[model samples]
Target: MMNDESLICEETANFTLGNTFYRSQSKITRDLGVLAAKIYKSEQGRLRVLDAMTGCGVRSIRYYLESDADFIWSNDSNPENKAVIEYNLGFILQKNKGKITYKNANNIFFECFNNKDYYDFVDVDAFGSPNPYLSTVLWATKINGLIYVTCTDGRTGTGHLPENCLQNYGSYGRSHPAAQEQVLRLIIGSSLQEAATMGLGIEPIFAYFSGSTYRVMLRLLPKINLSLDNYGFLGYCHHCGEYTTISYKQLGKVNCYHQQENKYYNYTISGAMWLGNLHNKEYLKTMKNLAISLKWSTVSDLLSIMIHESNFPPYFYTLGEIGRRGKLDIPKRSQLIEALENDGFQATNTHINSQAIKTNASLKQCIEISEKLINNSKVGKIND
Candidate 1:
């Protein structure tokens, strides 16, 4: 039992009563709060929300208190967590007249199966990779409903060896920034594929990375008249740096390069590179707006970095302006190429009108380039 003194604080009072609840809220949760608040304030209709693996019901409670969600269902497999959820909802129920339900079940798989009702918004916050619960969440969500997912298995999902991630997620890839982004996308894609098998379609609307966690928000769209199984994976050799992009149907083979050549070899095939741009313009706009509203400086900084490197226009700009403008004012195309070379990024300007650049470097050269860009302060801003 939580001590009585622990219950008296304002912060503690806002959360569910339990030893298993999160000690401090995560950035992902806080960001979710901002998005949920926006959705609640914008939409006038009744909203039904669910928090699978509610633990101490921090997410569910936030929705109850801050949003117009008519009903909030909080569930956890642990009895103690359920009890704490009940304790936390007491004050919320009294103040907002909101309906809160607490249930005990294996939320990783079974809770959605038992619940007959479909929710407008479903939040899944599992302790690790959320792969186990994707099917259930898909089933229990209403068509066109929003689903928020948090994957906490960063060490294995996003940060692990590419081969290890492939072995676990049935998709493989390296742990570079692009690869990490793809891993999260692959996990979501796998879930969407499963849902598609059941005649469902999901449109991912937002995704972002926070410390050790990748959160994605998707909307379950109606089953459009189309087949969804036209995606595949890419395998890359870590030793020789050779890459092969192949479909799921072509993934069965046994080749032991180590046994044949007596050298250490590793490769990863990941599911997230879905052969398309993951974020559409609308989604990017929403993310930009959310970032601005929340004053997320790091996200802004990363956006700037990505824009400078990719030579893409600002998120808020129109395509016409992007095209009509001869060049972006922030980063000269040539400077970006040089920066990419200095940072060891395999970048080449494929712009038909621009010059192409490529590099082949030894391991030592790659290390030096990386260190020079990341460690040395003398490399002034490329955009400047």
Candidate 2:
């Protein structure tokens, strides 16, 4: 039992069992909130935060304690958790008093979006798709504010259902080896479209796959960019494994292939998705520095890797996918990286998948390199 929330909780892995809190996510959520709060404080000073869909008020308290916030609004719809939240807040106030408010709202967005109100940070950690809250969250966020959103519907994100993914995210889906990265693009793209409607723009502050969901923190801006002056699309060529990303203006000329021009065919499109850089280089560098300065144990390592690989191209190549396409055995990750680097192409391991490499090398170059190691006698050195 924690005094602050008077939260008495039984921990269980099975969520189907009634009222069992998922205690395992506590540390991850704590670190993430701390990181978000500190980043907001550095850029915008004191924060006014909303811990939407808060369960038992743990996250709101964590943000209040760890972040440099002036206020925190923790809201949950479930009436059963009201006592638990009150107990925690009552005890918390006894120790460190702050302007922390609690509310029981059946639909959280209506409360946040009701007026000309704004918050420096709006965190929507919803149970499922997060699609329902995207528009409202985008509207409630202040210019120069931050929005940290999560989507637990990995099935739709990873392209398990084409129609459902399209319906929710406005992008037709297909399974790519880089499905997780694709999901990041899906969520960001969806938010961008919603923001653009109000002449707002969002730039990625941080994005990553954590546990069973995808979480992204974005910096909201009041002005919109011309490329995103409208919606967008991703023209993917299955034959050559290449993609051409175009905005609404360029969509008319989009073709899978043009034989005379010698472009690859078999293109199936996915978009109204944000075809933007996944990681912002300078921003990522700053976060990495902050992580180290704060002595964050595990996330710092991941953040460091993300910063180092930040300069690589938007998409990635999987070793197994490349090998299968070439009818050859997959080379060790280090060996593949070595081969690409030897050919003057940059290569690095991706956090998305160990066997996946984020590289500036084209898909053809990657396939060619893999074939060299396999079809040639050079395969002997792979074991060494």
lDDT of 2 by residue, 121-202 (tens): 8888777787877777876678888888888888886768878998888787676666677788788888887787889887
lDDT per residue, candidate 1, 119-220, as tens digits? 778788766777766667787777777878778776675546656666556665455323445555666676666677788776765555555667767777
Show where candidate 2 strays beyond 4 Å: 1-20, 23-26, 91-108, 113-115, 226-231, 247-264, 373-384
lDDT of each: 0.54, 0.70
Instruction: Look at candidate 1 and give me any clashing residue pairs.
Output: 144-220, 166-171, 171-269, 171-270, 172-269, 172-270, 186-272
Q: What are the clashing pairs of model 2?
A: 4-88, 5-88, 6-88, 189-274
